[model samples]
Target: MSQTIHINRVGLVALALSLCANAQSPQERSPIGAVLGTSTPVEELSTKASPAVVHIEVSSYRTSADDGDEIKNQTLTKRQGSGSGVIVDPDGYIITAFHVVKGARRIRVELDRRVRANSPAGELLNGKRRSSFEARIIGVSKEADVAVLKIEAQGLPTIAFSESNNLKQGQLVAALGSPEGLRNSLSLGVVSSVEQQIEPDDSLVYVQTDVALAAGSSGGPLVDIQGGMVGINVFSLTQRGREEGLGFAVPSPMVRFVYGQIRHYGFVPRPYFGVDVQGITPTLASALGLPTDSGVIVAGVGPGSLAQNEGLQAGDVLVSLDGMPLQNVPQLTWLLLHKHIGDRTRLEIQRKSSKIVLDASLISEPSDPEGSIATIDIEENLVAKLGIVGSARKHGTAGPSPTASGPGVLVVARLRESDTRAELAAGDVICSVNSVPITSVAQLRATIESFKPGDAIALQLERKGKLMYMAFEMD
Candidate 1:
């Protein structure tokens, strides 16, 4: 009976194939063929979104030998990496993962955007013309692994962003990327879990999916059936040597928020809450004599901060913020993220036995000094060797630099592509170069040019009221 059943199943499959082969007209074709034909929704969605999707190639330097007596001296070797990005602006703003371009000395974008003589950027080509452009890092948020890039082109294709708030578990999503450097590959999968915290105590959340992701997949867009971007593919959780089904993406909302902040400030504004809080577990609540088990407790309050100014103290159990119930640490951070600097909010905490309410406003730490690099003079401020626009200033005048006293060069801006082997950021005050005091922009430039490639240089930097040192090789 089993043999007979197997024979019948094979005969049915053969009959179906013969019928499909015999069909020459559309009307005679099988419904299955038509359903899976060239005009399917998936195909249409891919066609609509693939143009805006781009392949990102990054180049950075790494040491040939990290450790061992056999290799006492480390040599710089060029390393290449690939990832994916989506065009968010027609004027050439692309968004990708921070890891894709971090520590990269050079970044290049490969897109299908039209490259006409007068075209904006990538234009749909006939596989004949090359559409590649060098991109500059606009800003990056390491916490979320989102980075924004800018290319010098216009009329570029861009993808539309859809609200991810309503995404349900088991919803269909497609990932577009160049897995293993195979460009324009698309895979389909379902949302495994909406909220996934890969790390403990991390305030960031990811959109976990069962989507097929590989090495070259980071920074790609995870879109819905309608070709709307829902998330950016970040990483995959692999066990041993297999990738059965574990992928994660930075949620669209968080990416969008970071993008907006970076575009304006050239960095994510660090919100200074002046207070630290943790979740109130059952044990913690009982020990603290709190009323409820599920809540948040103030761990510490910064001195001279608005929290302390408004009577917020340690051991205070926070009940709500602006009437919204507080539960965990992530939720508190998320809620506070919605509040920008100067935004006033109401907080209710269970202090001792009474319910006390405190009203306070939010503030932020000093923004990235690179944000003010605009409109710099080309001739005087530009330090080509170090790739920074600088100005001379007195240390104790602006803010006392305990290490230095008189004149130093203030870094107003930094160019992404430079031979400098270290991260000499804007807002850093250069106190000296290799024990030789640097007073002005000319002195900084001259002192830097005095050293040649392979020479080691140490710079004393004053950043955010602290003195530190940055050392690197001249390349």
Candidate 2:
């Protein structure tokens, strides 16, 4: 999303509060009263910021076959979900949590009247003053839990981003979202912590707040008193599905980084060294006969990977990357996250009392083996008939390197409904058609061309971790 500062809502609010405080100045005030200084209140900030927030509703369609009956007809199931988003660009670019739209076949966004510059006064002829618009997915990064969406509108209200790194603990913050499908709801809290680890080993962190967030609040904006957005509301710690006042958000820096990468590359280009590593503590270092008390130990190097090609092997203790010392797995992971594909970096490794320095190039990590399927481009006629879009999975592409096994035509995206009764989904691997194995896009196209319209065809698909058979008539 592009940056813009049209209204300067936060600045205006701050200025107004400062003037009010000056006007109410006194010769002396109680210590307690001084400590509890008043600025822009939560209600005022919520009202000023609510224009940029939007309600998001999504519908996902999936095909379910009868119990133990593959040849019979299938049923299409619709699952509905709701969340919130903030307009970051007046040109209709929206930022929201990835989980809100994951696997969704259709997405709709509702904007309040205030978002429109020329909207009417505060008058509600109907229940609410809102307008619905169809939203399209621009890109998504599941690892960062951020997704960018686009709606067909212009000159919409937007929220300003705050420097989350400067956020202090106990600072007041407000969360705005559609909690429990209630639009424009507000919650108040303070920053409990700025560095909260989600993974046990990774260095990734989230901003922790004491704000109580509900199910529909995910992807909403966490704003400061001045109405600047500092974080994205994500999830809350709960006991028995009850709120615990322990909410977490993806800090603004990470949100900006992920959003920029997705917008430019269509996906997050996560660099990979193709090596599994573990942190080596002092005790483990002594047992392994290592020189340093802290470092990262390479457990296994992938076959034919850059690590293997560069002579990196199991049991090699990585001491540093480039010039930075890596004392643990998190440090190494953090360093790798900043690197891009084709980036060459020097690595200092210790092997059996011998210190060695080697250079290795990074490559994009391959898609998850269990979740992603190889994609191939089929004939235009077949694509139009099937209402789908796909691309042939290339070998040794710029993105994540593919594994040795599970080579087949991958389904990239599923389009709208067609007359065909076949059920195919994104990330599904089309292994074969009519029992004929398909290895490439050309093969899939040729196989589909062999069958005439109205012919019943059997498709062998690999979804998630299971193999299933689907039968549909060609139309």
Candidate 3:
């Protein structure tokens, strides 16, 4: 009896062991267990995406006057800036942020040998140990913050892009870049917001993330877990010069659009509406005797423009475009950006209590008559005399203006002396000089030419959406 009882106990133990083994088998495991069972996907993704990443080194020369007693003596300063880029084509085409390579006299790209060697059309290894290649700028769009570059080498590893429109708010993403000059660094984060407007008047949309982007990370690829590029890491918020966790990126769709346009035309063709418009509030609507507040009012129409030819006059309220309601300048800019030259778009305008529908063809944006100021010699220009380099405030550009409708020249770079007390910054829009209303760079130049060095001038400026007066002395 004891032997039989022991045999039954052994059989029961064997049965329990068999059941446990079967439950834990790979085939018998639940789907959730299978998904959570491995870390290979993320690991493999990082390894796969790393090769196509390139480190961008840019060198720019800026001429600035020394703050010494020798005011007339100027110094040439060589500024070295670094950013990151991604290979997007096998023929060594790269896409990076325009700000990365902007004003750069020379650009060098450093690639991994392993990535180049693995390419299908890659040349066999010789004794050459070089990895850096001199890159040439293909095109740049400041408004979109995208730039294209090309190198002489072929058979480079490239990254694939995911469908940008399908990106979810909470999807997992990895930002690959040289943050703070650290090469090939990866930071993981989820998409905090899919669509974020960086500025009130700007129509450019960005992918907002908490991915810890730093100085050198600009123009780097923001990738997904599947090793697909989704966006280009662009900017992060800084408070008191300290980096913040809030980061933004140009979405892949915009990147691709700009890239294609630049590759084909050597520049993104900006479609021109040739009409200046402003959003109308309820009070402004009542004051203007308009029907509703939810429309844009045409402030000025360009002379001899298609808008003027189509009878779009000032004081006409734009109600809709192509069946979509036009509530603000941004909405109009956004629609215009997606359109191409020669494309016809219907506009519904409210003119004197009557709704008017006008068909207008988009034309290549006419170069600003004041755009020549960009090519003006910095040392000889009046703007430089004020210790700043600035551009005219236009309707579609980024900066602080009441919807970019204010008359001013936006300061882009400040080259002030240490002893100077001017509180002007890069984004400060100079509204006037010496109590004279300044509208364009040409006007600012004319005003500055009327004054001599050491003349104290009152500058009406807008900083961070606040209007303040500053006293600056001409150098």
Candidates in descending lDDT order: 1, 3, 2
Most accurate candidate by lDDT: 1
Q: In lDDT terms, how accurate is model 2? A: 0.71
Stronger candidate by lDDT (1 vs 2): 1
Off by over 4 Å in 2: 1-24, 27-39, 61-77, 117-130, 277-297, 315-318, 327-334, 350-355, 369-408, 411-475
lDDT of 1: 0.73
Clashes of each: 5, 10, 0
User: How do the residues 1-475 of candidate 3 rate in per-residue lDDT, one tens digit apiece?
Assistant: 0000011222233324433444655566453343234433445666788889899998853444222425432333457889999999988899998778765668899885455423333434474534677888887777777889988777678899886668787666778888888887777666778888764346577888767788899999998868899999989998998756678999898888888888888877888567777767787778878887665788898666668988999989888889998867666877887898888889888898799999978877644312222233334433655656667776455332354337688765555443345656656778888788887776787787787778898988877667788886766
Largest TM-score belongs to which candidate? Answer: 2
lDDT tens per residue, model 1, 156-258: 7788898777788867677888888878878777777888866434667788877778898999999886899999999998889688678899888888888
Q: Tens digits of per-residue lDDT for model 2 on 157-226?
A: 8998988888888666778888888887777677888877665344457899877798999999988878
TM-score of each: 0.69, 0.70, 0.64
Total clashing pairs in model 1: 5
